[model samples]
Target: MTLALTRDELAEYLHEVFPQIRDDFAIDDLSPERITMRLLTAERHLRPGGTVSGPSMFALADVAVYAMVLARIGKKALAVTTNCSLDFMRKPEAGRDLIAECRLLKLGRVLAVADVLMFSEGGTDPVARASMTYSIPPA
Candidate 1:
């Protein structure tokens, strides 16, 4: 299926609506059932044990899934996450950037579910995994 919004368009929407996270992430690519997000990692994103902070990972997962949904549905700012569950599988490399590859599992009238796998830049194993559900507001 064709996407309603392009990568650049979604990035602009994010910048305008979610200014606080403007620097936190950027869209790497967007496709029919896939999306890639890059985490603008910095010292602030690092935890005490030389790994990315949990909140940082969570943010990446949330934004990545949101991007996936918006790509399919266009500028749906009212679509809010209704559920989120994340598991940190391993410690992410401290210096490298993090990437989230998202896949939408189900898209319904009111809710959309997506699963995200987070990798540490060039790493082969996923450092974290997340499942997110968004509540799409009435039209």
Candidate 2:
């Protein structure tokens, strides 16, 4: 399906609907096939060892999929995660932003599934991987 929201429109919608996390993420790229998201890592997102925390990575993964679903299905802020499986693979680099690449595995009338790979900025290897399923609200 064609994208229902452009990158800017999606970003704006997210800011409007989720004001609490408005400053935490940026949409780096967007398309029907995949979306690239950046977590603007700060002290609040890092753990004691100066690496991006598990929770922060989870947020990135969750948001990336949510953004992808909204981009395809229009501004449905009520869509919520029903299942998430995340794997922390390696240490994220210090002083670097975390990036998540998301691809929708399936997008149906009531549900969507996505896979996400997260990496530190400028890194080739993924620091984490995630699979998530979201429940879509009825129109």
Candidate 3:
């Protein structure tokens, strides 16, 4: 399948919608089936236990999937997360940045589904996983 938005396009859209987080993540890879997001790790993302915070992981996964959706459907900032289930499976590396691998499960006009696996940079195993559904505002 042809992709409507490329990595550069996603970055531009991200810059427009979320100026704060635009500096936090970068589009590492974009494909018809999936996307990879890299977090620019910082002190704020770490927890007291020397691990990445759960909220940070969740945000990474959420934005990663959200960006993947926008890549296919174009700018739709109103598209918001309706439901999400995240599993924190393991400890994350506090010193390294995070990576989110997002796969679009179902993309339609009103609703979309995507799953994300988050990994600590320089690691292969997923530290957390999330499944999210988005509600696309009516045009």
5-65, model 3: which lDDT tens digit per residue? 8889889989998999967898899999999998888888888978888888889998998
TM-score for candidate 3? 0.96
In model 2, which residue pairs have backbone atoms overlapping below 3 Å? none
TM-score of each: 0.97, 0.98, 0.96
> Which portions of model 1 miss their true places by more than 4 Å?
none
Q: How many collisions per candidate?
A: 0, 0, 0
Q: Residue 58 in candidate 2 has what lDDT?
A: 97
Question: Candidates ranked by TM-score, best first?
Answer: 2, 1, 3
Predictions in order: lDDT = 0.92, 0.96, 0.90
Residue 90, candidate 1: Cα error in Å is 0.5
Ranking by lDDT: 2, 1, 3
What lDDT tens digits, residue by residue, belong to model 2 across residues 1-139? Answer: 6899999999999999999999899999999989999999999999998999999999999999999999999988899999999999999999999999999999999999999999999999999999999999999
| Model number with the top lDDT | 2
- Model 3 CA deviation exceeding 4 Å by range: none
Q: Look at candidate 2 and tell me the lDDT of residue 78.
A: 93
